[model samples]
Target chain A: MWQYEKKLQYPVKIANPNPKLAQLIITQYGGPDGELGASLRYLSQRYSMPYAEVKGLLTDIGTEELAHLEMICAMVHQLTRNLSEEEIKGTPFANYFVDHTTGVYPVAASSVPWRAEYIASKGDIITDLHEDLAAEQKARTTYDNLIRMVDDPDVLDPLRFLRQRELNHYQRFGEALRLTSDRLNEKNFYSFNPSFDKHCNK
Target chain B: MAMKERIYAYDFAIVEMNLYLDTHPEDKDALCLFHQYQEKREQLIEAYEAQFGPYISNVNDVQGDKFTWICDPWPWEYSKEV
Candidate 1:
């Protein structure tokens, strides 16, 4: 039961319309390490998580990722607004404009549409948490790459904010991993899947 | 717009504290901070909605005719001043 909040997680007011930049930023919308994948990964993995802390973390973080996804779309929409035919004629966005026409679509900079294969929901708690840790790092790297290429302060502000969030999420996920492992067998955390092997301790 | 920014800031703090508390559920200080921000956030939201229509769909502060929920300039819509 999600409620709609008619506001973005962060404000994205791009004074300049840069379709080229939009093409790049849209990658975060549907890229391999995009927010879409991040949200789905955590939300889907929560069902199999064995600990209360892990479950709550996944739900909260997953919801925040959805907010991030909306922010990304707002960026893309603002960047591509009011483009002329001439403006779209020579840029890489021409390919996208032909299909979407100033509309935002979830596709990578390379024009790959979003797919579920970008995420993993392993039923094992340790494996799933590790997967989440790696996912956060990858998303942080993507934001870093975006920041390096962007010069607009308007765009850079939100990118920096989102990049910081990735770091925070990584830290939280690391804590979640530590908390999870602390409850498992001290010698071998992977000896049994706590999510499924209920009687292993006996 | 200033009110909206205040609401955003307070809400942001609440969200950050929420994620922190998720991992550190027993931390009384963090929980206290979370509640404080939440209280301020409610005040900000009430003030913002009074002047700027509904911040969310459930606010239900419509007046006169027309459903204001479908108002122009959705969050995604481009505006020079946003």
Candidate 2:
């Protein structure tokens, strides 16, 4: 059961409205390596995780990803708020404007709608953890790309914070992988699917 | 700082401590901090809800529910107001 917390995990206050930047940052909100996908993937995978530590990691990180999702939405909201009609028609966001009209929508920078196919839930602990680790790196890289593109300190501050969080989550996921591996057979970690096979006897 | 700001601070500390405790569950000091702030958070929530409005549902006995949990002037809205 989750309780409502009315505060963002990290504050996002963008003073200037730049439609071009909004078009780019919207990617994090619903792009291929978006936080929405990350949150759903880990939360779904946790149900089948074999060990307590890994499950806890997935739950915690997945919850954090939800927080990230909120921050990204906040960014998009503040960025696109109160745009003039001319600004909308002059910028690339004119296309998005026609559809969303200053509303927050989850679509990639390329204008692709968010899809469940962006994430994988294999139900295997090893497979899921590896996927999670890779996901973190991908997210970090996306943030890096965003950081390079934007010069506004307002946007950059939160982007840096989010990037750091991805690194921290990567470290925690690595620990989860180690904890899971330690319990498996020393001879062959791949001998069985600990989540499904009752014979492993961890 | 305003009461809302104080509550936000407490909640932020609790969140950071929570993430730490998840990975280091056996760490006694982190556990202690988490419990301490959790209680502080609950107390602040109670006090704030009594004085200002309900930030959390049913943490304190709020009067005459019109389903104010979905009320306007949300926390994010308050930040902008500040």
Candidate 3:
């Protein structure tokens, strides 16, 4: 069961509206390595995770990513809100405005719409944990890129918070991998895929 | 910060502490802090809903001529200039 919390993980208060920056930031909103993907990836992968701790980790981290997604959307919304038609005319946001008209649409800075194909929920425990580790690194790199591009302090604050969270998630997922690996046969780590080959593991 | 904003801050602290406690169940200090924040959060929510509207959906018994539970200025709209 999920409970709704009325606050964002980190507050996004951008006093200045920069559509150009918003275009880049939107990538993390719906892009391949974005929070939305991160949330969906862990949540979908949890069902097949072999251990209770790992499954619980996936649920907690996935829920946090959902909050992160909301924070990113809030940043994008504040940055693009109330844009003058003239301000939008000669900006990269022109294309986005044409389609969304200041509304928050889930698409990358490259304008690629979010797709389910970006994530995987391989039923194998080890494979999914490895993927989770990689996904966290990818998200951190994306945040690094966004931090380098934006000069606004307001925007940078929340982005830094999110970047720190990616590092935290990476650590958690790494620990989960270790925990799962420890449960497997020490002589042959890959003796069996615990998720699918349950009979041999027990 | 406003009263509502303070309540949000406390709620966020509780949520963060809860996640930490989830993975580190043996951490006594962190567990203590989580309880502290939880208490603060409950107090803030109670005060806010008393003065304003329902912050939590489960406790929405305070009725009025207008359904303050379903009013404007949602959480997203709070602190935002939109």
Best by lDDT: 1
Residue-level lDDT tens digits of model 1 in A99-131: 888877789889999999999997988889889
Candidate 2: CAPRI quality band? acceptable
Interface RMSD of each: 1.8, 3.2, 3.6
- The list of candidate 3 runs beyond 4 A from truth reads A199-202, B1-6, B47-63, B78-82
**Candidate 1, lDDT over the whole model:** 0.88
Candidate 1 off by > 4 Å: A199-202, B49-59
* Tens digits of lDDT, candidate 3, A1-202: 7876545666778888899998999998789999899999999999997788888889988988998989889888888877789999989899999999988888998999999988999898888988889999999999999998988998999999999988888888887887777777765567677888766452
Writing each residue's lDDT as its tens digit, candidate 2 over A14-47 gives: 7887989989998998999999999999999999
In order of TM-score, best first, we have 1, 3, 2
Chain B TM-score list for all models: 0.78, 0.70, 0.68
Query: What's the distance in Å from true for residue B8, model 2?
Result: 2.3
Q: Please give each candidate's TM-score.
A: 0.94, 0.87, 0.88
Point to the candidate with the largest DockQ. 1
Among residues 3 or more apart in sequence or in different chains, the pairs in candidate 1 whose N, CA or C atoms overlap within 3 Å are none
